[model samples]
Target chain A: MSNQILIPKLAIVGVGLIGGSLALALKAAGVVGEVVGIGRGLANLEKALELGVVDRITQDPAEGVADADLVLLATPVLTLTEMASRVLPHMKPGAVLTDGGSVKGSVARAIEPLVPEGVHFVPGHPIAGTEKSGAEAAFATLYHRRRCILTPTAQTDPEALRLVRRVWETAGCEVVEMDVEKHDRILGAISHLPHMVAYSLVNAVSSYDRYEENILEYSAGGFRDFTRIASSDPTMWRDIALTNRDALLEMIERFELSLAELKEDIRGEKKDRLYDFFLRSKQSRDAIL
Target chain B: MSNQILIPKLAIVGVGLIGGSLALALKAAGVVGEVVGIGRGLANLEKALELGVVDRITQDPAEGVADADLVLLATPVLTLTEMASRVLPHMKPGAVLTDGGSVKGSVARAIEPLVPEGVHFVPGHPIAGTEKSGAEAAFATLYHRRRCILTPTAQTDPEALRLVRRVWETAGCEVVEMDVEKHDRILGAISHLPHMVAYSLVNAVSSYDRYEENILEYSAGGFRDFTRIASSDPTMWRDIALTNRDALLEMIERFELSLAELKEDIRGEKKDRLYDFFLRSKQSRDAIL
Candidate 1:
């Protein structure tokens, strides 16, 4: 734990899963003095207040971050620019503004210029989530043993970055840093593309003419995992796809070409080749484990 | 629980994960008096005996099932026919024989006629396993809270089917009965096709010229699950693919069509169509959960 509480007045915009969880973790560690939960929905804001995820609630970002030292934009990627624009004018001179967007490049580009001269704007993404969402689904352990990547530009203030890193480190996250563009491409290959594939696989199964209903009953190990991924929040994933369109499209092409090769091998009954390829995949998977 | 210990002498032909787990579960339940594990490797056999997965070990199938009331053929799908032929002649009168292979239709056809007049040959598959293999990787709880599918043809003896069902039930499995062809078709859509897609996805990433090493590092949520499936037993999957080639090939073709549709949607910037499709997938996946 740090020597003292770093965030005396922490303002959490869009107090959903990520926001609520960060507040809970910091509060549990006694590192956050006051958490002000801000959201468009009054019901969810009330829930966050009742659950002690925040000490206060606000309907507007402008009012929420008025006196806060750190303001975190934890809403959808599409809304970050507007949220940041509203909060920046009300924020104190030396306040830090960060985000927890899944895709950072677009968010960073949209909000970086809006951040006041003295205020620090660091775009971050915590690589942790369940299929569940909203404040009720959040917990202090959501970010425990997970990674939180902060994409800082050349103009980023050192103290701002350090403060954000300390916040994540105290939450039990391994902080990673990368250029925004590289983060997009890397996440395109791993996170975004895989989500697309999973959704497509489920769609593909549903389009089957003859054996639709029987498929789920026979689903044991492999198909079950696919469904679990495919069941993730669709709107959130759609926004991610659209925001990171180019890198996603490129990764999709790469994936399809690889898929074609395996299809060819299977159709041609190249047993030895198929075995070798499958073995290589197994080895790659083992490497990760 | 079955009031009486059903099997006095149980012989398992291949002492691998599924077979070893079944032996351990039955022995722990006090349902089997003697367990004879038959395998080609002396080292594995010794480990199985030491682990008490079996009471004794034998290299010869004839010697293994000589005095057994129940015999389980838990070998590869491709080896079922030969293994059955080897053990059938030596099986005791009124003994029951079953298998724990993934693909049932081919194995059922291959070994059905080899069953003696009074013997039962039930083709079964327990839908539970980790990527880890061999006797040491097995546990008594492997089959707990899992489904065991048994396919019995018209020629199958009633008592043999009952005894096999009882064995799986005693091991804390929910025993399900399906026709042999139906099992293959359903498994083709759900199990075999998913494995192929996962392997293809992994191979696709590896083929990327610019992003091979960076790809694995960025792997999160969905990618991790895909790699886990891709890491499964290669030879076993290869055998399932070959033995159930017709169904696997058909399902693969079905999956390719679905993938092609999604690819077109993404290329054309069909956001609404993609969203609706993704939503449908989420709904389908939720249905399974």
Candidate 2:
């Protein structure tokens, strides 16, 4: 790799788990000329610096991205649009601007109009995370062996797309490209629907008047697995649920149909139907592993 | 413990994962005078003897339990009632009979009438298992640090209950006693309901046509967690759902209500409501950990 392309100066906003981890990975690979961290909270910025995730901390997004060759918007999806608008004015001419947002369609719409004529914008989502959040929870290896999806609009610059792909690839993620709308629908089926199921499963057990004691005692049975997914960041998930409402509703409708069929099998004591579903589902999991 | 009490002659029916595991643990602990394994299949019997899970193998339940002081019914729930009935007439008069069934209420009712006057019948469930099944999957440490619930009827002998508890405790489980009805309800809420939800979630994604490929590719986002649970033994789970129909149905109703509320929140774009539910659910997970 050319030194100029390898050691590009980068600015990361939010400086939380995703952003902090990106900085650490870039620095560890010796691909970062300088990593400027920006966040609303001073404590988080300080923590990122102490963890060696970033070379400098800045409260102002403009100052953070002032001279950077690439700027990554790593804030919550709810704030990504506004944050992109705020930082667009300060980005260096021809610098590529990208985001790490869960949902890409709305984000692409939100940032496209605000970007300077010379700057390129790409929307990306790294399909990896933990139940815990914050800068302290980040590590250099967070993105290793994970998948990162990049969604670029028709007008997106090819060079900008390549640069973003290279960044994630160098961070040890397998990079794939797809259309924004298609990405949203796919993520809704695989990610959003599962989270909804987990949250609902927890709510079902908690709703029972006398279940609290027994639930805690016998949780090892199976409920504990759902709880781990249900324990994800509340604000992030809430934003996802609202933003991907159409796809989520459609998925939920299909889920209800399946649930009803299962209930019928149980009600009618149809062991064969239950057995077939269970065995088939297990094969899918085995394929994944 | 006295040698007579600690090393009682044992007979294990079915000789699959649970049965083989029990025999292995007993032998490892030197807590059994001898272990006689009984199953319908000659192959399984040969495998059990080859693996040393049992000291001897027998095809006849009558001959297997004839000389044993402790008989363990570790077969599937569908076969428990019939097998117990078959072996009851041949079991020693003072022998203790117990089962490892997921649902307790039905098992207790099925075997209660068939048990002999002097022989003790205690229905139990060890809340421990892996996705894998069969004798090949058996391990002596299967029940280590796991919870085992013994659901004995009021007529169960005190001495028999004590001996049953001691056996499970020796196998490295925390033993608790509960009414058969309560055990069924509790297990339904925690284990049965969660498994059903996981199956529903997987089916939901599998039904989507447009984005199926993408969904499978990005399953690591969160969907993969549910797949592992959904991949459990189909025959065993189907039996559980059918035998515990009432309790499972009650839980399904509660889950649907909760899910509908969540759907409404998403459709209405109620961020705060979704956030609050996620936060509350996350708190419960933290408590579990």
Candidate 3:
């Protein structure tokens, strides 16, 4: 409790994996006094409550955030604006409001205008996750040793940004601040584009399942590693693909160009070029690993 | 040693990860009386001898294969034909020869003609590996619970095929036989295409490294998993690509078409189509997981 960020009441809209994990981490750290889980699904809310992810569960957003000191919207990027509008007016004045959406620019732009005069809106993205989803998959250490990106604009209040940063830091995140546009572009290259490629690769291999043998059945360590991200939530990825369409499209184009080069080298039997392509990629990936 | 397939002497050429692991496994199982390690690199061969993966080390293919009961050519696919030609004449009349190349169709076609009149040749691929290479990365348990595909033709001796299957089975592999052409096509869809996608992904993300921030520095679990196979041996992958060019090219084309559909759905903001695209891929990947 010595280094905890004090929040008398915390309200989390869309208390699934991200929200449930935040609630559990804060409670385990003895920071927040009480957490209210809000979502459209009653079954998920009940499960969150039973798992000690939240102190209370509510279907109504207004009732959930009525007296809350801090509010977090941890839903799909497309749904954030609607959810924020529902909870912002009911939140206590001088309270800090934040989000855990993957795409920051559009979500921040859409939700920034709807924020009340007194309540502060700070946009954030935690670069940590598995290919799993739902409240049952939530864990207290999901944020440990991970990076949490916060995109704040000129309109963002200093105290509110500090509080949001403290919360993420308390949950075991190394917090970093960056421009929303840069965040979107970088994430598009690293995260969104990979998801698209993984999904496409899986579909491509499964297309051959109509033959006598299921190609997927012969998948070894390499194919399984590639398919791990392909098994992520469909709705979540669909929303991501739409919200960050422009940046994601640019990244997909770049990736296709890179892939095309290798394809041509393979087709032409250019062993030297193929070796260089693979060697360069290995060097790049090893630098990061 | 009762259940072991005993060989008076086993000669392994190109004793890197695959070759070294086979030697170590057979030695540990007490199936072979002696193992001679032959390779282009003296350092690696000495390491293999030091690690007890082989009882003898030699740079001469003829000296290594002289009087051997079995010979395993475990080099890259492209080099298999030349290596086979080098050792085939020196191998004993009743000796069985096999290979551990990823691509089978072209390699089998190219090497089968060079086989000596009295010796047997069986093309094989073990569906197992780490992103590591060299004799130092070899281990006895590398083939445990893994699938090893053997492609034997009309000209192959049944006794030779049985001996090769027993060797892999003793190394804890589930042996399956298939046509060389079918093996290449299926491995093209499963392994080769995935490696291409992963290497391209790593290259695309690293393209941003020319900028201020290294995008790869922020790679999380998903990106790391996707890059695991990208870090595999460049020479080995290059050989596989050139040797299996036609099937790999076809698979890449199919993957591009599949990716294009997802790109269009995202570009047009077709939410339902995007959802269905992801949903289908998720279901396919999840089925195998």
Candidate 4:
């Protein structure tokens, strides 16, 4: 194809939403020669194949990465430690390796030692996803008008970083790079902390004594709108929460302090204080909304 | 028109989102004779009339409720206390009075003494709204298939309670009744507490140093969805937090406890505990998602 950017053979570890969408987007752009999926589930990989998300499926990472010019780790944060050890050695010499996990600091630290000299390892996060998971949830347009943040370490090869950036850019993502540690703290505050609070808030209502009778019956769209992230993938969030523990904890503490101030304001019936707090929140949210 | 349920002369104070939507719904259903809007802003009333949300506009409660068959106090919760005292003297004898505020116990208590012996007074909360407010935000379908909760006290007039229920029912709401105290507690857990958490969470992110640089740049739909309620009316929420102070405080404590447990799970790297917590949250949210 004219004006096409090609990966001779692309290897995607974990052919679910992130991986499958990447594969679909690349294929739709005529930018990849072959896309191979390395995942545990045969049914899922087969479904990925049926949906044109992957050209082939393999149970072995070595086999999948043998001829891969690009090997993208599209798995959970905690799983990347093991995935790095398994996939890095098998990657072709001069191949570019990257990841698509939310917390980059841990992934960059965990996978750095495993990368061979010629292989370029860049940790990245695509800020796009639905509550839905699995290969069936893949969509070529998932990354369109979205951001893909690349967190490349000092060891990253310049050419490899450029190629990785092109891949996401070609997939219709606006790519920006940042320090790995900064990425974790950023994602932890905006993404992970909000997720934790949404889940906990829903759980608080769920476990309340009169929830089923009192709370659930009176729940309107506002509650639903506020807690929709509670429906996110459980295991995925657990891994994210753990992998980004320190940052998440710091964010949680800060959030708790804010909540405490609000509680005290309510306790004191401080209308002015309460109004200021609410107005600040509204202004902040309004900017983005 | 034979089986139509009509409000012969309905007076709606504070023609904002709730009042405007109620008038729109009633008008669409051919169930209201003449709706008079009483709001502080003449432009808002004019807009409500333009949108066909109200048939008439008036500045004075005495003028609006003079010959009304029903007077819906659609003002902010804190204002409802003074509004009840002001409007009750103007209502026709035996006219039914109700409200569309989120908090029930306080409004019911504040207005109970002011309500004349011949008049029926019922307190209510229509568990429906959008982030947008004002007369312009009203829609004819805002209450469709939604629940309208009536929190009638022991002193509430039975005929007024029935009539208030029918008003919401005629607007296409599924009506349910609960004790005033119970309604506050239930709504505090599900609705009020969730809103508080959302606003606090957003404020936390907004107050963070270089948040626009570090956080907002990478925000995904998940964060946006979870924080949408943070954009709700500032004064309305401040009033909600104060009027329902005790119940909201109790609910906030319960929510804080839940968040603490989660934080502990993350800090301890208790994978199983974290997984279970997320799973329960997912299950709870799944039932409603």
Supply the TM-score for candidate 3. 0.98
lDDT of 4: 0.88
Q: Which 10 consecutive positions of candidate 2 chain A have the poorest summed lDDT? A: A1-10
Judged by lDDT against the true structure, how good is candidate 1? 0.84
Interface RMSD score of candidate 4: 0.9
> Which candidate comes out best when scored by lDDT?
3
True contacts kept of each: 0.64, 0.77, 0.82, 0.89
DockQ of each: 0.63, 0.73, 0.85, 0.85
What is the C-alpha local distance difference test score of each model? 0.84, 0.85, 0.90, 0.88
What is the full ranking by TM-score, best candidate first? Answer: 3, 4, 2, 1
- Report the number of the highest-DockQ candidate: 3
Q: Tens digit of lDDT per residue, candidate 3, span B19-63?
A: 989888888888899899999989998988998889999999999
True contacts kept of 4: 0.89
Error of 2 at B194 (Å): 0.3
TM-score of 2: 0.96
lDDT of 2 by residue, B5-52 (tens): 474789999888888898888777778898999898899889889988
Candidate 4 chain A lowest-lDDT run of ten: A210-219
Model 3 chain A scores worst on lDDT over the 10 consecutive residues at: A1-10
Q: What TM-score goes with each of the models?
A: 0.95, 0.96, 0.98, 0.97
lDDT per residue (tens digit) for residues A215-285 in model 3: 78887777887789999999899999999999999999999999999988887888899999999999998
Best model number under TM-score: 3
